[model samples]
Target: MMVWTNILVPVLGTASDAQPLSVAKALAAPFDATISVVFASPSASGLFNWAYEGGFGVTDVAVAAIQEETERGRARCGELLTALDYPKTSFETVTADDWLGLRSATRLADVVVWERSAAGGHGFFASAFQQILLDERRPAFIADRPPDVGGTIAVAWDGGREASRALRRSVPLLKKADRVVLLTVPHAMARPCDGARAVLYLDDQGVRASTDVVHTHGDASPAILDAVRKMDANILVAGAFGHPRLQRFIFGGTTQYLLESLVRPALFLSH
Candidate 1:
């Protein structure tokens, strides 16, 4: 079994979040893990284009700020690791013209921690959360708050391939958590016993878990959120973009709801 030893956090120079690093440190504490903080800085040409396109007029100061931001990110990373008492931390700064290089960095980690979009900003990733959800083969932890360490974990299971994969990949986290709750909602093909099987599967892996069939009247997202609150779960692990791309885009989906509505419990999403 692969332990979450190498954690990667890619920071977007435009309003980044350090909570991901904090949460990763907490998760890695037991294993004495190493965190690699990669600062994705925009190229000078990219910054020049942004300034020119935005009618701000490119200036030496503007370009210099971009360069300085990368250094600031490195300094902050070191400070945060020291504050968190995590010594096995390393920092790297990469200048990427686009999101491609950033996406590639995701592959280098056993797991990735992503910060939710910041207000009045485009967020850490230039692309949609879907891009990371789909592109990264590893589990992506997206959260607005620091995830509760060793607290209750709520798994949103819908009996879909995406949900199953999320559950399977969640074992490492599950092992770390104090309790696991398998949360399921009604669907066309979903059987009540389905959640039970998930419970049994977790039991096989020595994860203490129970299943709850949450009843919801309207949009399932609210119900899912309700379940998380009622259970007081620290993290909500679920599948992302489960619907077909076109369908999900046209008519929003559960992942979209969780991202938009719930802000307390951190989201651990996978596809």
Candidate 2:
């Protein structure tokens, strides 16, 4: 069976209408299977940045702007999909309700592709979404391009659950990968998790894999970029290796590091 590759775009309850169109563009950008779009509805009221910027303290104007953005976004998405020469979609919407895990008319997603918006103060929601995708065992793509183009992939293998999860999730691109590297950071934790680790796992799964042992640079972000260039990899895969705030449950070093990085497209699987 073909693995599903998903593109998740955040509508932020404002520009959600554009999500399906964005997904369609991403899907058409590559030669692949199963492209999907997703939007999350706000469960609570929050400040509308655009509305606030426009000096709209009036509730009616604020409501109108949000609805208009949502409607136009959706219609544009449909038109884009049609223009791109894809079949008419049976599914598309802006909602927060749906069992994403089940095959339903409303949910036709296998993975999520989120927009990488810059952090607004504390980026808790994006971080939460990241953790959700990891926990769900689904790949998350923070897109730089419409659809994540898969050519070369860099796998940060340290024999951990998250790293391994990233590698496993990357199976869809592996088949079409021109090159792939299993980069190992010689940190304190280099024990093998059985053939369940990376190298061995990739072999068993019939994915083209190779390995490289390197010292962990000051931080992993730049090191990852160096590896990407050295291996000519466009996509980077790694476990979410960061500290989490116990009280707030916010992400720590490595997670923040990767997200802050503009080096390459990375797939982070959380533990």
Candidate 3:
């Protein structure tokens, strides 16, 4: 089974939304994993000059703000855990020194829980999300609200390495799922061997997943989304495939479509 001993949640500050943490807690509940919360607050020295004209420098103000934010973040985490009533959930906190430190923290985690937004940029969360997929080749669980646990899971299988990696990475959740559906487009075979291979693996782990090959004339993302709704899946696990050279998301593909359109439950993405 896939073991997620460290589920990382990198928050901006106390202003960070509680949805991501709630999702992380839900995901970690089954495994009894540690929810490692890393506050990736901006470093004052890097963003501001300590030596300014005025006696009170921006550096001092920024430092004070960050310190206060960190304290509030820590306290808020406690409140979230209490509100969620995840008493068995154990957690730890780490303060990243800078963007690099945040990236490092993201790289070391099993799966990252992040918020998906329409406003795309190279900001801290966006950079971490991109890096986790493009650079670290890790799975990121994107959610706008608290994710439900132990429901149906949909896996978009394409017989590629990226898809296979996503399936393997999602083994833990698959085991916990009441039903696992391998959603795929119409292929040449009755059941694509790639999907069969995943089913076999899941069978070994006691997760009975059936493959559904739907016929879609145009883009597959919409069809997949339809299947997700029809199957009543709580989560969709898929590969974060992108261009070979460009350091950006795929312009018109399943990855981009879901990232932009998916809003309800959660998306567990691996590249």
Candidate 4:
């Protein structure tokens, strides 16, 4: 069983941080976890590239303007954290190298939380999301909304290594849930008995969970989403499946599908 003592929430100086911050608060409630909110600013080179694409030449003035904007973003993040007023929280500003700073912070955190919208696009947040899951192999909670931590939680199991890691890492949250359902797709599993095993594992961790086998013909995302909706689960814990190819990580079909789903439960994922 995993115990989350530190929860990291990376913010991009946008209002979208609210949802993930709220989720961090809710998840922290049961464990009295400390929330570390870090402001991740785009690197100077990245900002310059964006400005160059926008018809602005790289000049002293351009660089100065970018620096000023970065400061403003950091200040904005600070103000937002102040407004949240979470008791067990700390704030930090990471500039110069966004990825390096985030990577370091993630290493110290048991779990990282990000806004769901950040999981898409080619922006810094999206890249960070992928890096955290694939490269860092850390558990992340991508919030679609403020999650009900005590509500029904669904675990997507396939008896794979990633699935087992996700389940084990999410034990703390599962133990706090009002209900836990282990959802499995028989055809998709290499070993069909993993679902039953998962139930036993959860039971051993003091989490009483039921099992449900979902039958699907094609893509598993639809059936999984439908089952979650029918059960009214607030969160879906699953393993993020992906592989590195030519120095880039490509998400597996089901993982990509779930990440792209516009309407779904909050995803608790691990790679």
Candidate 5:
């Protein structure tokens, strides 16, 4: 099984960041993983654009105000870390450069953890979330709530390279799960494989898993979510389908659907 020793959680200096920090602690407990919490301030260019769009021209006063806000954010993050008091956790501040600093951090992390709210929209947090998954090609855990890591885990398999990678990277979590289910939709798969193959692979890894084939005519997200809900799974492991283009990321249909529709199960995704 894959051993995860480092888990990174990038905070945007907001109250929502607390959820992911708590979730990361829970995930790290099983592996004795160390959590790296970094306060990622918004890029100066992004802040300038926001100020300009709001009719507050790019003036010295405006820039100073933005800088002050950034400092406040940093202070807030420091306070949150102090309150957490996780011994195995380390804290850092990433300013001056947003993406590059975070990118470097992601490169060293085994998995990046974030709250569900941080994974949506086109803000800095959302962009960083996508970059960690697509650009860095690292595993990420997007939690809507605290995940029950020892509970049922549902894996979405389609026999594609992305799906295979996701499954492989999730071995550590699966090994500790009380139950493992491989959910497949034949019609929706890009490269279909026998569910038995996946079952055998899991068995080889010492994680006994069962297969469940769903018959779906249209989008696969609804069917997958329905199955996950029915099984009362706490975590859904799936491949994130997205490619970076022209400095932006375009998500695949099923992946986009899952991101927008997730309500109960936390997503464990890799690209």
Candidate 6:
């Protein structure tokens, strides 16, 4: 029997209580045994201490203090997790200077967890993990309000590299769907690419897929959401694009819009 590898979600010591806590509960609710949790413990800060010591040579002392702080921070994260979540499941720590946490724990996960919007700003140390983790092309599930993922599954496709990546990640979950709807809002006056590439890619891997391109007027998010409700989709899937701005002022980006309005549980992968 092919064991459906449970889950691999990335946790930053910085996640909000609701999202982090919710993710933990979701994992433990159905498949705790097959799950492995990871907390990307990047240094979060440069190693250095500048306390005016006996003399002007305070760099070394400051560096030592920083290292101590980082190590302690890592330890504290593990200490903070719920006891039953993953008692023996080792939490991989990726130090700040590396791919996520110094080591790559992504390979051990089938699905990755991410927040719809970033929770930090300038001077934040762990924020880089967002782009890094998303670029890893792992299936990333983002949380929104309302939490409607236990029912209909809606998939957004444009067939570009972005949509292709999203489709690839969604296939694992698709197999368990009671109903799957592939909706596409093609470029204005342009024909849907038949989702040829993504469909072909999934076909090569033997994924069960079907499609429907709605010729609609307006932006992709509204149309997508309308279809989501129309198709009775509770769980939605789409490719996301996130530019690491020290601050994101995305009032018009499709991904950003959906992130802001998604009340149901949705999975989104960044390009």
Off by over 4 Å in 3: 49-85, 88-98, 118-123, 187-194, 243-252, 262-265
* lDDT tens digits by residue: candidate 5, 159-178: 76677888999999999999
Best by TM-score: 4
Show where candidate 4 strays beyond 4 Å. Answer: 45-57, 96-98, 242-253
Select the stronger candidate by TM-score from 1 and 2: 1
Q: With candidate 4 superimposed using the best TM-score fit, by how many Å does residue 238's alpha carbon deviate from the native?
A: 0.5
User: Candidates sorted by lDDT, descending order?
Assistant: 5, 4, 1, 3, 6, 2
- Per-model TM-score versus the true fold: 0.83, 0.68, 0.81, 0.88, 0.86, 0.68
Candidates 2 and 4, the one with greater lDDT: 4
Per-residue lDDT tens digits for candidate 4, residues 211-251, read 88888766676788889899999999987754342121111
Query: For model 1, which pairs clash?
Result: none
**Candidate 5 pairs with clashing backbones:** none
- Candidate 2 structure quality by residue, lDDT tens digits, 1-271: 3465444444443333354356445543454544454444431134454446788664766667767766765666556545556443333563433334222322345555554552111442455454445345455555454434457777776665566666776676665667778776554344643323566667676777777765564555566567767776767766553334211111112555555676646453433
lDDT of 3 by residue, 1-271 (tens): 4577878777664445577778888888778888777766555554454345344556566778967776776787677667766645455555444346666766667888887751133455775566666677778888776667688988887766667788888888888888889977763223445478778877887789999886677666677788888889889887676447232321124455676774454888787
lDDT of 1 by residue, 104-147 (tens): 76676767777666211245463634465676656777666566
Runs with alpha carbons beyond 4 Å of true place in candidate 2: 5-8, 12-32, 40-69, 83-85, 88-90, 96-108, 118-128, 134-137, 146-150, 188-197, 241-253, 266-271
Candidate 6 structure quality by residue, lDDT tens digits, 149-247: 345677777655555666766665555566667776664323446655665665676655667676666565666677777777767776555344322
> For each candidate, how many residue pairs have backbone atoms clashing (under 3 Å)?
0, 7, 0, 0, 0, 11
* RMSD in order of candidates: 3.5, 6.0, 4.1, 3.3, 3.5, 5.5
lDDT values, one for every candidate:
0.70, 0.52, 0.70, 0.79, 0.80, 0.54
TM-score computed on alpha carbons, candidate 5: 0.86
TM-score of 6: 0.68
Candidate 3: residue pairs that collide: none
lDDT of 5 at 145: 66
Q: Tell me the spans in candidate 5 whose CA falls farther than 4 Å from its real position.
A: 43-64, 96-98, 242-253
